[model samples]
Target: MKSELRDLYQEVVIDHSKNPRNFRKPEGANRSAEGINPLCGDEITVHLKLAGDVIQDIGFQGAGCAISKASASMMTAALKNKTKAEAESLFERVHSMLTEGPKSSVNPEELGKLAALSGVWEFPVRVKCASLAWHTLRSALAGSGAPVSTE
Candidate 1:
């Protein structure tokens, strides 16, 4: 069952990487930010439309590895319609799950599809790949309009 679950998650990652969701600029996004991982040359732009404290819409565009692209795609899908606070909480949780090592106690189920990326911890280097989009999303939410770099 564990292997089956791994296979399922791998398929999810590959599917999203090949055919990303919300992978375009929205009609009128109020927040936008870009993130780059220089080591692997992965780049991502996060676009968000917030209505008051609620995120009405979110999307992304960029060139990256399967892990990065899939992470961005899944993140957008999970965060749409969430309030600013909710999204931030998710960011903290997902960031922890990604960076913390396999010994982490973070419950992936709490993150929804974002949990598919839990396996990323296994590949220490790829942890950044899975987090680029998330960091970009946080920057966009900050309304900095500044480019983010994973250094």
Candidate 2:
């Protein structure tokens, strides 16, 4: 990554961590799931208010590392008003980015602020932190009552 870009990414992460967006359970949420990273003690709950197959709203609340908190905030911002299929597709793209690093095939512009998290792939352990909210979001969307665990 270029120096300027790396700095910007760092700033984005820090800003989100310090002041996360959508960090609450939304009213009228019909589905919700919790995620825990036992390895790092990051825990989050993702909530969704769905109208048919579309996510009318999304929110999350948790106590965790910066990556987890920021990921939850960004995930909520990204998934709101998106259809279930679109949300699933975005999850796959983000999972790939967090595990394998950013790919040229996935345009950063498509991910918006989420692309800032690409740098997290370098720290494998932190991947769980970055992904906890996403996994919880999926479980919530799936209507799975089980809590997600990164073990």
Candidate 3:
């Protein structure tokens, strides 16, 4: 990545981390789940309002590293109005990007601004921080009350 673009990505992550979006529980949320990253003490809760198979709304709340916070914020934005299948596909893409080595080919354009977080692949441990909320989202969508653990 070019120095200028890297700076921009860093700026996006920092901005989202400092003031995460959709960091509230929707009153009518039908599903919710919590997640923990034992390695970093990052805890997150994901809430979802589903209309049939589509996500009518999504939100999150928690505290963690910049990557975690930013990822959750971006996730809610990406998932709004998306179907469960679309969200699952997105989650899989992100999972591949995070775990399939840094060279993994996940199209940034397809992921939108969330592509900025791809830098996380460089730090294996930080990958947990970035993935905590995503796991929680999956659990929430499944209507499973069990908390997710990224151990």
- Top candidate when judged by lDDT against the true structure: 1
Please, what is the TM-score per model?
A: 0.92, 0.91, 0.91
The better candidate by lDDT, 1 or 3, is 1
Residue-wise C-alpha lDDT for candidate 3, range 3-73, written one tens digit per residue: 64473348788889988999999879999999998876889999999999999999998788888999999
Off by over 4 Å in 2: 1-9, 102-104
TM-score of 1: 0.92
In terms of TM-score, how similar is model 3 to the real structure?
0.91
Q: Is candidate 1 or candidate 2 better by lDDT?
A: 1
Candidate 3: lDDT of 72? 95
Task: Give the Cα-based TM-score of candidate 2 against the true structure.
Answer: 0.91
lDDT, candidates in the order shown:
0.87, 0.87, 0.87
Worst 10 residues of 3 by lDDT: 3-12
Tens-digit per-residue lDDT, 1-151, candidate 2: 7874473358778889999999888999999999999887778899999999999999998799888888888889888899999999999989888887755366655799998888887777778888899999999999978999988
Clashing pairs in 2: none
